[model samples]
Target: MITVLIRLLTLRAENVIPEVIWALMAIYVLAVLVTLTSVWVTFKKLEGRLLWSLIVLLVPFLGVIAHCLYCLTHADVDVLKQFGFFTRKTA
Candidate 1:
């Protein structure tokens, strides 16, 4: 195992493309999973449901984080209001 690890660490520059592609594919799969889980739990209202769902499916990496933050703030307005500094009420 250690020998294989050493060989990977010494990969030539030309071999990096396939490795990068695989890494990106893995990240995309993870983002899809996150988006699916969010659909099951977070988004309920019909307002931005389709829009946010598309965003989560299309943008790489940060889409999941964005969806999660949206869900967080939407679901916990009171929690944020308790902090006072974290929430601004619109007049």
Candidate 2:
């Protein structure tokens, strides 16, 4: 098993860097789109323009994660209340 794993690792090392970079780029784009969708949905639900611009300007994957965490945990109950959408409720 160890020998097989070592062989596989050696083989993968030959082409893994480019493949990993491509995957990261794809994930980044997907994250950006998800963030944009989240912001749009949030705006549509809440009828406010508070964080959309700021979130969109951030680096994609990290930005989406940040926005999601903030929306889920922050104490802005009024926003969630106004939209009738809470993370816990959705879960």
How many Å off is the CA of 44 in candidate 1? 1.9
* Candidate 2 TM-score to native: 0.49
lDDT of 1 at 5: 42
lDDT of 1 by residue, 24-80 (tens): 688779878877677756657765677776777788667788877776766676666
Q: How far in Å is the alpha carbon of 52 misplaced in model 2?
A: 2.2
**What TM-score fits each model?**
0.49, 0.49
Of the candidates shown, which would achieve the greatest lDDT relative to the real structure? 1
- Candidate 2, residues 17-78: lDDT per residue as tens digits? 55556766787888777777777766664434446646556554566777778668854787
Instruction: Report residue 11 deviation for candidate 2 (angstroms).
Output: 14
Q: Rate the local accuracy (lDDT) of all candidates.
A: 0.69, 0.65
- Clash pairs, model 1 backbone: none
Model 1: ten consecutive residues of lowest lDDT = 1-10
